[model samples]
Target: MMFNKLFSFFTVFLIGSSICFAQNANRLDSLVTVLENNKLPKNEKIQLLIKIAHNHTNTDEGMHYAKQSLQMAIEINDLVLQSQAWEEIGTIEQRLGNKNNALDAIFKALHIYDSLNLKDKQAASYMQIGGHHVGEKEYDPAIIYFQKAEKIYSEIEDDLYLAFVLTNLGEAYRFEGQLENATTSLTKALELNKSLKNDVVEGYALGNLGMVYAAESKFTKAKTFLTKAIAITNRLQGAYPTCVYIAALGSVYEKEGDFLLSESKYTEAFAMAKSAGLKEQIRDFSAVLTGFYEKHSDYKKALKFQKVYQQYQDSLVNRENIQKNEQLKADYEVSKRESEISILNITNANQKRWGIALISGFVILLFLAYLLYRGNREIKKSNQVLSDQKELISKREQEKALLLQELNHRVKNNLQMVSSLLNLQSRELTGHPAREAILSGKYRVEALSLVHRKLYQEGVDTKIPLKDYIQELVLGLFEGYNAEFEPNFSIADINIGIDVAIPLALIINEMVINSLKYAYDGIENPLLKIVIMQETKEDLHLQVIDNGIGFTKNDNEKNNSFGLKLITSLIEQLEGTMERINTKGTHWEMKIKLS
Candidate 1:
């Protein structure tokens, strides 16, 4: 990674290269000479001093310059320069690991920027805050800050900074394991950087894109993207991020079953990380290369890297523990000094004074005993109340379960009666189409009745296990059709609310009936499949497919049948969408959102 890329991601909001550019002695001389020429405005001079302070943030001189700039800005009452000074101070604090203090300083800058309507500066401050949050690994808050910065950058038509913020936002999302969102944001950033001819931004974005694709196991695309990214970073001599890209490519090659290429890339990345003195990257490469060698049956190399990785990991842990121990020791000394001073405040006392103190202590002990006795009584009373409430809650739950069971039983009976009425009516019909319609209606009613039957079968769980319900429903449909081929079901054990279940069952009934009545006509070895699964926490997917004969768009337009319309209506009722795919036969997919 170039220093800019590291500043963008690893550091807490380093801003642009201009903010902390490598110190050029000639440029520093020119700025100092300009400052010495007393004709310039003080506010302008303060800005120059702030730039100097920003450049020196890694040293004590940085703090001195920032304080001097802040003092001058205050004397002139220049809010703009003051805000700039505070932000520089905040950057220094963040680098020193004083996160809370950094936040305070940055927010102060943000407030002034907001007051001055300095949209770009406000965006910069937001990005800084976001980077701080990312350093803390509070990704959600970091995303929110980045989003705020994004909005400002958008308003100002600052596409370059916007792209930078998006890249960071994508990294945050990637770390949070939101791969889809990360891909979207990073792809946008990549496009913008390319359009703007920003090679640095483009390189970083490509590296991130490669990592995202690799995580999704799109190895071909991952390899292509990472190869391009590595080429770019190599041309720019960005060894840090180049190591990252190489490591990512190594993992992709590993997964692609190219052990030789994987090892080569990993070895190269390790060498780069070692040269860069990036301890974390060194540890990571060692562990992954160890695994690669082991998988390749090279036990000696595996053991070597394994030992190297363990040594680095142990060193890191020891360093952290030592720092913690030092802090604890310092805290102990402070407390011990306070204790010694407290002891020295006491002096020798007479016997009469000691006796009075003992009497007072005895009286205080008696009072505490009375209070403890009362506290025990209160605890007993509270426990008694809790026990009674627990019994009441249990009783109420049982009663509710019984009531729901009874309701389901009644609804099932009512629906079954309706089904029987339709069956009787179908028997009296002479016309073939009329009789078929009646039977279809009867089956539709029976589908819903089956839900209630299963609802009350085992317990009063209102949410029904869809696997067993779908199995029973398909069997009932087979019996109704008197067909030899039984439909197959791949149903997950997902429980859906009754409101959604009723409409879903009706929708399935309509689609399956239409397939059996029309699609399978004159077709041998008819096949039917039903799959119900939860795609996500919010999405439930249902697919009913058949392999017999298919219908075209023109056929659907000509028919516009009641079954099709009913399916559409029921899907709408359940707040879902349906798509029909016809090839050898018809496939109906319904996507429903759960409440």
Candidate 2:
């Protein structure tokens, strides 16, 4: 009776597997027919190729089709299509048990998707990476990536993809022994899929939930959920999830002391996995059967199943070795092709250079002949014309200089009038908050006016003498603030263009104002020193030191004020860096790079 029952079960299983295979074959045939049209657009062809690859995911044909899609995508320079192809290739590699290669391909896809800012595609790649990590029994990283995918899917409001991520996340959590989290994630995924009417992912979530319950020793719940999961997975999904659900059901039965039913379910799942050519599942089930028989002291059956388990394990290792060898051969062929292309390019470049050289030599000879054909009178006339042009250019340059100086003088006068107006406004607003702000504006305007004043007074319009400019600016600040200390200057005899001079002057003005207003409070004697030295041909070092109280809390708060922000902007404009040291007093040092 038992033999007949087992035979009947095998027959039904084989028929169902055959039906699934036929459906896949029909799908592949239809896709290939669509792909055969040579007049199809490259983009459409790449899409079809990817679809075909997905259909053949269980075999090498999938990799072949994926690579074809990648090549076509590259030819058309379509980044999105290329990323999709790479993602398909990664899925195929993972199915083929090349975990490392799968990870590498998926990461390549993720990088491209990230660059293109495709959130959906990035989440998909993250899920793929998490699945690979789960396969390797590395649950921590698996959960991390699954959570990352979850976050993105939620942000995009993609409940369908979110359900898929949650299903995987729950499974990873179950494997890592976090049963509560596993149940929570799987339950949410189940509800999401049901709401979305996605029966496929719903089946996955149900199966994972069953596995989690089993791990928690809830035998009744585990069996109930596993049975329902098997019904849905077997009818809607395929051999993979159905086989896993069946194995979990068998384990639940064993825990409940139903030895006969447990053995039957294990044997059934193993046979189905073996018939489907799922080597990983086959090896796993065989090991389970081996342990089951040993628990019952059935040595003969235990030995038989143990040998089957070892056989498949060896087969997996040999397959990996063969894959490695094939990869090495492929790499060598690619390298050889690249070297041949490089040599051809060099030969073409040398030929082109020789052709250019011949043409240039002939042209040069013709030019010499032309020069000889000309008379001395023509040469004298050309020389006279050149001299006349030079004289005219020099006069124009002198005129431009005079005009620039006049413009600078007028700009200085205008800025002084603005400063005077600000002073007048401050007097009227005495005892008001606006008065202080107006005075600060006056000082900044004077700093800029000083730059223009130096440009108009100096012999050179573009360059300013740094030593003289700093001295006058600092002295003017002291007189404006009515400070009691005299500032010492140790400046380098350097010349700078107006671009650097204007910003530098404002920076000095702000720093001096900060020192006078904040640094010298509650001090008996105050000293301020300004130093500028040439660090290199294209670098300058500047120091502003004050012998008073160090940088206080008030100064820190002032750093966020408009004055400090303006100083920061000017420093950035000059491509310079500043460092503040509060030892002894407050020391501000800067390194400015000349552009």
Candidate 3:
């Protein structure tokens, strides 16, 4: 199933490549014959050259004609024509597998189009650039460029080209595993092509939609769409894309558990691809068959197809290598010619400059010696000033650190005094409802006091190690409640600043108090677990679980409880969420966003 999905992705590029070079040979010949007329006007000749180049894509002849058209357009100062010529050159180079050169030429065309405000041509250039990105399997940039082209084509009401961009855009979405988006774009493309009566692009749109369905595992719909696509391509005699659709149908069959039918379809598609001389399709289908046979435990057939796949893979690599060698040779020739011209120019100029060169050299030496002496003197003065400034900055930083430490120590002492006063007040109101509230307030104050104490002792003013603080906080709660066992702790190593630490500490205090008071009633062995970890760079996950009597309906509905309200307020202040579960015990899960 995975192989089939990958096969669908690989064949989209093959389909695109085939469409590019599938022009009628007779039409190309007619264009060449017309080009033979020497009396043709320059502008008409330039247009003819571009047309011929488009028909000859993926061939050196196409590049030659494109360059010729570009030169003529430059001579006539026609920016639109020049841009069109560059677009053709880019498309041909891309089809010939020269990506960098392709992008360079396409951007050149885009620059010219932008300067001229040629919306239609600019959109076309964007589509070409998008197609290049798709060929490289870079779907993000491909989708971006395709959307740019889609917008312009829609604005211009160019339904034909709009369909083309939409089709490619849908294929890119499918490649990126965005099946719903792929369906949307392909369906729109299918409608546009139908309205425009463009059978070729219509077939492509249908084929891509089928692949999207196949990826989603909707085998019935997959077969339906792929069968329709096959019909269209078959009627149009599109052998390459037809074979691709057939292979996609085979994948659908494989996923549906129709092994015999799947094998037949795979073999049929392979035979058709081989007959059509589609090397990429042949290589891909060979691989698919290799996998299919291996799964069926047919080692003999698997080995045979594996060797065939390797052969075609090697052939494609060799073809790319040959193209690179030819490019290198052309570059070397150009460089050699440039070097010969530079040598000639240098030789002619050197014959008349010997006496002046000696005079300039002597003057330069004296100027260099004087500048070096001045540079040394300035360097010494700058170094002395830099040293003094550095020392002053260091002294100021130390003073600031000492001031922060003193402030934290004072704050901790003041918080401890407040807690002591709350404790005294709580003792005075014995058996009174207000005593509970005072004690809760005292605990909250202690939570904040711990944070400051940690800062003062650690001598770090800003952030505190939260795991150590949480351990101490939880241990203190257990001791305050006189619990029989310590709660399990699974805390990650995280440091947080005071802004987050204060509110987070208060939240934990409220939650632990509620669990100790309400949970663990009549339980033989109470269990408590506290988990704190960073779930992402900007989020922290905390879980406080206890195994005791679960919360009753009344407990769950206590929205007005002071402790519950306090917990909610602190969580809100921290920009966090809380979830409570009551099964065997109480479970408190919270995710806080870190600033």
- Clash count of each predicted structure: 2, 0, 0
lDDT of 1 by residue, 1-595 (tens): 2111222233333343353323455666677788788888888878877777665413356667777888999999989878888888887665544555566678778777866888889889988878777755678998998999889889989898888888878877876678899899888998887778776667767888888787787878888888998988776555656887887887787778888888889899999878755565677788787667755656667668876776665454422333443454365346546756766556334554675566675877867866886999899999999999999998788667777776787688678657755765675575777898788889988988988988877566878877877788878887877878888888888777778777888887877777777788888789999988898998898899998678866776855678777888888877889887756788888898777
Clashing pairs in 1: 1-240, 1-241
| Candidate 2 Cα errors over 4 Å, as ranges | 1-29, 56-61, 315-595
Give me candidate 2's TM-score against the actual structure.
0.49
What TM-score fits each model?
0.42, 0.49, 0.48
> How big is the positional error of residue 147 in model 1, measured in Å on the Cα after superposition?
1.5
Model 3 agreement with the true structure over 341-385: per-residue lDDT tens digits: 999999878854764466566878757756876898799999999
Instruction: Identify the leading candidate in terms of TM-score.
Output: 2
Per-residue alpha-carbon lDDT of candidate 2 for residues 1-595, written as tens digits (9 for 90 to 100): 1111111010001000111211346677988999989999999999888777766525577689989989999999998888888887877666555556776677677777766788878788888878877876778998999999899989989897788889888888877778899899989988887778766566777777777777778878888888887887676535666776897788888888999999999999998777656667777888788778867866567667877876676565433443454464465446546757999999999997786676676878757656765766698899999999999998688667767776787688678767856765676687998888999999999989999989987943699999999999999989988997799999999889898888898999989998898788888889999999998989889999998788667667767889889988988888999999758888999988766
Model 2 error, position 488 (Å): 81
Worst 10 residues of 1 by lDDT: 1-10
Candidate 1 at residue 386, lDDT? 100
RMSD of every candidate to native, in Å, equals 21.1, 27.5, 20.3
Every candidate's lDDT: 0.74, 0.77, 0.78
Task: Identify the runs in model 3 with alpha carbons over 4 angstroms from their true place.
Answer: 4-26, 56-79, 92-101, 231-240, 257-283, 307-595
Pairs with steric clashes in candidate 2: none
